[model samples]
Target chain A: MEAQGVDVVVLCGENNVAYATGHAAPSQEPARAGATRTVAILTRTDVRLLTPPPLDFDDGVRELAAAIGDHAGTLAIDEYPSMLVHAALAPHAPVDARPLLTAAKFVKMPAELDAMRRAQRINEQAMDDVLPALRPGIRDTDLSALFFRRIFELGATGNTVDPIWNVLPTSLADGPFTFTGHLPFPLPAVGRVLEKGDVIFNDAGIDFNGWASDFGRTWYVGVDPDARQRSQFRRYLEIVEACRAIIKPGASAWDVAIAAREANGGQPPWFPHLYVAHGIGTDSAELPFCGTDLGAEIESQVIFEPGTVLVLEPVVWDDGHGGYRAEEVIVVTDGGCELLTDYPHAPYE
Target chain B: MSKERVLDEMGRREVDVLILGREGNARAVSGAHRLFLAGERAFSPGCVVVAETGAVHVLSVTDFGVPADAHLYPPSWNPATLVGRVAALPGVRSAKRVGVDGITPLFEALLTAAVPDASLVDGEAIMRAARRIKSPDEVDHLRAAAAVARSTMAVALNGVARGLDDSGVVALAMEAMAAEGTTTAAFEPRISRAGQRVTVAVGVLRDGWEADVTRTAPEVDRPAELVAAIARCHPGVAVADVGADVHGVGCGYEALPADERLEPGMVLSVSVAGAGDTVLVTEDAPEVL
Candidate 1:
């Protein structure tokens, strides 16, 4: 921070807090109105954290200003500032430090990489324990229940608060259903029953300790996948493999996307900005995104270095075949990429 | 009461448009209160653009989403693409002044470039003020969620085991909710182990309504002083801060302070660890629902 001429850095996001501070600092969940919100400050010499008084302040803004005092060269996380924090600190012209922070975070510390490896291990083991229990008539929620139970058994405190757990059939994969989301439907993992030939396309995520794991997979239920299912599924898995083969230290983030797009049969996806691959660690979707959606200039500017963990998920969306997206977490290695997640890419239990 | 409060508060703030910004970070997967007001549920980042007159618009980005109505963008809107859509919002595009639920330098820059002349102000107070009141449907959802939470807690803590870790206890509650037939556990089920300060904050969603309740396992019995401090709570009664954990749980988990005066139909989870039963404020007394 001093080298960058940045003075005090205010850490608000949980992951940022965890990155700067060893443990995940408890920040108030921002789901409510007028609840006590916490913010932490990191300076050259000292670190201070502040929270709204527990029902004490009539003018919380005034108190927050006093707490902030007169720090001029301030830097705050753009993604997690509160209204008061923005209003009060805007005048000081705090440096938009997200880019700087993201850059610093891209090259993970050895411990950070180890933490991610730990998180993915628990995530993969949980999937392993629950896959064999799959049947034709099981409800989506039943799968979620067992899958999550296994995660806990393997040592995750809990999954990320809004992790996606969609369990739908291949018939509904295309236009009608979203394969990735926390609450894609009115209810998550309930009432929806799976039948034979259904595809369990999951983009579920979980948090172990403060680190997070995000990956996607598609599994066929009781029957062997038909030709249409096999083709669509193969398209996505092949793209992931193709992208995986190209990733290495010193690869351009944009070239990674363009080459992956070419390997993905040279056509644009139904939607835009859906990266063929993107970096992931604390945040599921971080910088270094590559795909046809990011345009050529942006793709050319993205470069990957050693220690950066990225999720390569090539999606195939056929209106008739529905949709299929399988994600794999790989770390940029000196020679090539190392697969961190050991979950199966094949559509099977 | 549904959206009129938003308009009224915006009117009071003299803001022509109110845009509720995204909550959490890229990895944080929760909706802001704006989504609740707009009657939309999206896990990804989105914004609710509100007019001075309470007209609400939702723009979301999801993998394969089709909102029942045509409200969702056909190509769905991600954060990168949302700025253009937000700039195009009828109320926002026409506004001379705008109020945002929250702000950041990056978002402020986007807003400034989008609406050059519009002055931006904080709309957190206005949004929070409007969120305090619960509609009939909201109350029912809270009740249903509370009932499930109460049962789940009972089952999990019935014979509390020392071997259970944080995730294991949460798994028990998730299984319990599933067995009871509610798919959405409003928030992710949380369980801190016994020695690490056992706490439970469950946000369960039914239909579109959410009920949130948090409780910490009793460590040492709070002496009579702490118990007596809470005995005075009732409907239409002002509450001085007694310092024990107190918060109101409603449409978006918690939207009211614990020390505020209780209103009828308002449900609160109050205790040091959020373990206190939810109390529904009524015309006369605060009923422990």
Candidate 2:
């Protein structure tokens, strides 16, 4: 903050608040999250949190003003509660704190990495309980039930995404029409019954001590993958290896994105609306986004520093047949990168 | 029916356009089942409602649960790009008043730059006014959500009986809720054990409506203060008199003004501190769901 000449920093996003103040409440839907939101304020010398009662009843403007206590310096905030727009922060012309926060969260410390690893371990172990039941005639929500139960039992703090067990159609035309003309993925689970030859794209996440874990895989129902499905998985693995080969301490996100594209025959092997890879920490998807619509200029600027954690998810779509997809978590190191995800590509391998 | 109500409210409030970032507000207006993500998303125009055309434009990449005629815009990581997309919506350029449920400094600046003539106001108030009174079908959805919550609470109680720890009991309850086909929880279960008594607060969202309840294991008697507060849940009763913990329950934990009078069709979740129940205000009596 001193380096940027920012005197006061206010954080309103739940994960950002947790990052700044070490205070956490139960994870919730957006509406409830707004009603029960907390704010953390940090000055050059002190950090304070305005929580509950006063913040709720008074709309947080008065409470935030009181917490700041007359520092009359440049203010920066990740989000602005509009009630405070003119009342509390307009005078300071609060600037966007996202860039500074993003830079700070770009690389993980040893403790944050350990917490993320623990989170992923719990996620994988819970999936261990969920996969055995992935037979024909099971509802999508049934898998979610088992995974949710096991994660909490394994000491997970929160469930991040709503456990996607999306069944893919054979071709792009058979699926819902997407604006990008590419494959649509990761639709929310709606209790659809599994059929004999369904191809399931699984994605879910959980949190352990404020760190997030993302788990994704492609599963075959009731039988082993056919020849074409195995080939798709091989292509997916090749794309992942191509990206992994260039992920080093000083590599730009563009390098990794280009490697994946070249391996996939010069086409982006990821969802159009989504990314080939994303960074994860307190927030499920944070900085170091690779191959997103944020534009190529920004992607080139996001350089990988040592201790940067990335979730590389490459989708290998065979237009006539169903596709293959999975997520691999890796941490960039001085020597190269180390894999954090330890799940198997069972049906394909 | 809900969209008509929103349109009516928009006319009454004299707001020409609504750019909603809150999921509950977006779901209420668009009737689209977008993906459920936990925590606060950075402010962006997730849904846009135009008064002139009565059209709902949702920020969705695919037409999964979206209405066929609704305008769709793909997701962008850049706020400037999103602002440009929203600006291209019909009747947005000439809108005199634009309401937003939430805003950030960057978003507000971008919106102002995009539509320089429109005045930004509190769209959240308009949404609350439209959603405060639940229709019969909305009430039915709320009742269904309440049943799921209560069933999950029962599973948590069962875990407490088996001497499981707090997280273990939460696990059992969450599993039970998902088994009932409700995968999204309203919030993480707040369970803590002190001595022989355990307090369990569980909430769930089925479709879009919400049901939240708090209870104690081993069945402790309801406190007199809570009972008195719940008794005031009747038509024409001021919400402040009802209690601070009492909040309107519908798509989300709807916020009602403390000075506002309780209406007959409104549903309320009264949590006096921690233990409470959801009730329906009627012409004569309040029925507990």
Candidate 3:
């Protein structure tokens, strides 16, 4: 705040509120989520929160204005409610707080890292129960059912996304058409039943007290991998290893992006719309995003600090045959990055 | 028919174009099955509805059951890029008034700069009016969603009877809902245990519509408060007279004002405090689903 010369900072987005206040709320659809937002106000000296039961646009703006009191300094805000803009904030022209937030949240503290580790442990253990139940007759939603039940039982605040257990086609031509022509992935699960040899790309995320755990791996139903599939998995590991080799404190995001592309023969190994590695904290995807549309210019400027975490996901596409995809959660250290994702890459492994 | 209804509302409100930011509004407008990501997001243009051409352009990477005529654009992180796409839509740049469900400072600037002549107005009220009356297909989807909610709800009630903890009961209920092919939940199943009484509520979203059901342990007759609320759900009665907490249960939890009148084809989820079932209001009577 001092660096930006802003006296008051207001946040309305849920993840930003959670990050500011250390409070977690039940996740809902967008409309309900907006209507039931929890607003947080941070001044250099004090912090205040306006939770639900009184959070419509008009009342929220009034409370926010009241909280600001007589401060005449500049205000930074994460979201703009039109009512707020038309009423109290039209004069201030609130500066965007995302850059300030990104800088502050880029490096995780020890306690935040511990929270993430616990969240990942819950996610992985739930998968341990889910993986054994994957078979030919089980539908995609059946896996989702088991996964949801296990996560709540094991203690998750909420499920982050509809658990994706997408059954990928052998060729991109057979998959859903995309404007980018890159293979679309992580589509919502339906009642599609698994076949004996179908390859499944699994991805799920859950919230544990405002911390997010992102899990991704590839699975096969009722069959061992063929030689081509095994080769795909091996190649995926090679790309991951290449990225991991240079993920030390001083390394730039561009260096990791370059290593993954070079390991995959100069082609970006992840989805074009997505990233090679994204930092995850309160939000499932956050700062230090590498290999996204932002490209090399922005990426080279993103330096990895000691406590920065990255989820490295690289897909090894064999085109005619199915491919292998997995993600590793690693935290940068003084020496190198340490793996936070411990789920085994079995069947493929 | 849904699009026609929305267009009619737009004509009534004199909105030249609509830029829907909420996922439910976008889904309601476009009839697209986009990926469901949980939690609140900052407002950005997700779907654009051009009044002049009646074209719905969605921000999607792939056409996941999107209508054939609807255009798809890959998601962008840059606000300028998004504004540019919205500007290029057939009628957006020439529009005199652009209605948006929500906006942020950055998008407001970008959009204003891109379309210099357009005035950004509140489309939320227009959407609420358009969405108040459910179409026949929307009713069917909501009915199916209610059935899906009941499938898991029974398991939850059973768990409450079986001496399970709140987490255990909720876990079983969610699993059952998913097994029925509904992975998205409209609301987290709220289960609270207070001495002898255990209140369990579960809601699910199937095909972008919502249905919510709630029950308590030691199942008894419907509470008088809720019964009175249901009885008052006639075509012209004001919702405030219902004497309970009533909310519209459709694409999402539609938070209507107390004075809003109940109309035929409006589906509502009513609870005194927290024991409610979804009710469909019609000209003759209220049907509980």
Candidate 4:
């Protein structure tokens, strides 16, 4: 904000407000909600958060405008509460600061990184605990619930993103894969029962104290070695290698994405494209998203910088079988990228 | 909805076309009428334009196959792109006054530049009034959603043990809801082991309707005064003035203002609005739908 010459920033988005003030505004729970504009205004000298009674929201908002007087300069805001924020800061426009804040938060502080590491421990524990229980007849949602509950047990404040269960049928045949979207939705367990020899290829981002840990593993349901299974799993390792090879401080977001796709023998992505790499800190999905058009990024070409915590999720797939996506969180360092979460993809390594 | 009623309201406000983009308003309007507008599921600042003749044209993200009759932008399209798309829709070009539910600052700029001649008025109150009462089908969806939640809580609580942590209990509850055919749980369930305090919120999406409810632990019941104050909220009374504890529970988990009144069959999530121990507005007392 200081670099952008933003005189006073009024944090309206819940996540941004939480990031700025360490105070989470009253959320509507799984929805962008709150009646009164309990906003945080950051001036050159002081910071103010005016929370109004739900009844006196209009009057409270009127006061918000008065607080943001004169030095309107460049106010940054998120899109959800853009209407109310705009109404309150009328005349003084709020540029969408999501991109700005997202970029700024890319370099985690030592304490922030420590918190992220602690968050990954739950995911590590869940991966270890759930595998032994994996077998035929387990519903996808149940498995999701089991893992998610494990994370909660590990002390996750709340999950910014939901646990994804893209469990495939035993037969590796042509069909729609149940991969979760980029949106932070925790898909309640669905009733699709797993069959013998089925592969549970899942990905999830757990919000541990607002820090997201993205990691997942692929497992064969109560089965032994098979040529087809081994070959499919090999492709995932290749993509991971491709991402790691170029994930240095100076790497380009687009180059890493193209590399991962090409690593799968030049196959077009199932969803047109995949965000092979994304920064996660305050919000589950943050800036420096590689492999896709990062709209409104301050930088024309997003160069990787040291301290950038990236979730390198390179998905590799084969024909007639479901895609194998392994999300390994990494931090870009002065020399190379460090693996933050190394939850294994295969039984071997 | 009575198209004539909406058209009448639009005429009174001198609005040729009422453009609604806010999710809450869009869902409320769509729930009232069975015609689900794809634009309602769109990005903020996107819209469903209700024409003066009662025809609805939508502009939303492309992932959702917007009806062949409506407009669709790429899933990656932002609000500014949507504002332009909404203005170019068939009816909007000819319309004189366009009423919008709400506008972001960036959106306000993009809109003013795009439709210099058009008069844009905030039409939230008008649309709210139009879609105030829940239709029978909407009521059915809400009922199914509520029923699914009740059964889910039953199954979850059945599996709970003294040693189960917050996450484990939540998992059991979610597993039950998932088994019962629920896809969305409007909000994350709140669980704490100290007093076994749990606020299990279930918002199920069935037949394109989202019915929401929250269930707290049996031990921690809400104050009787708070519950009574919430019950007093009716179609004309502002809910906020009733009491500081008053909250909206069903559909969207938002807090209503002093002016936003509760209508009959509006599934509210006021501390387990549709859950056990909740009352439905009646001449006598509460009854399950």
Q: Give the count of colliding residue pairs in each prediction.
A: 14, 0, 0, 8
Q: What is the TM-score of chain B in candidate 3?
A: 0.97
lDDT per model vs. reference: 0.60, 0.86, 0.85, 0.57
Chain B, TM-score, each prediction?
0.73, 0.94, 0.97, 0.73
Which whole-number lDDT from 0 to 100 does residue B25 have in model 1?
18
Report the CA-based lDDT of candidate 1 relative to the real structure: 0.60
Q: Which candidate should be chosen as best, given lDDT against the real structure? A: 2
Ranking the candidates on lDDT from highest down gives 2, 3, 1, 4
* TM-scores of chain A in all candidate models: 0.84, 0.96, 0.96, 0.84
Q: Evaluate chain B of model 2: give its TM-score.
A: 0.94
Residue-by-residue lDDT tens digits, candidate 4, B88-189: 766666766767765544566677777777766656656645544555665666677778766766655554544565566666666566555453455445
Better of 1 and 2 by lDDT: 2
Top DockQ model: 2
Worst 10 residues of 4 chain B by lDDT: B33-42
Compose the digit string of candidate 1's lDDT tens values, residues B1-289: 2456667777777878766643411111122221111111112325454554344554444433223322343122234455667777656667887766556556677777878888876665666666666667667666887788777776555424454655567677766766665544555565665564566666565443455555566543344543543455566566555345566665444545445776676666655433555666667755555
lDDT of 2: 0.86
The DockQ-based CAPRI class assigned to model 3 is medium
Q: What is the C-alpha lDDT profile of model 2 across B1-289, one tens digit per residue?
A: 3788888999999999999998888888887888888876666889999999999899988989887767788778888999999999989988899998778878888999998899888787788889888889888999999999989888988888899988888899999999999999988788877788888988898987899888887874566766777788989999888874888888877766678899998999887755888888989878777
For model 3, residues A34-85, the per-residue Cα lDDT tens digits are: 7777788888898888764323345555766777566677888887654334
Which residue pairs show backbone clashes in model 3?
none
Model 4 residue A96 CA deviation (Å) reads: 4.5
| lDDT tens digits by residue: candidate 2, A319-345 | 989899999999999889999998888
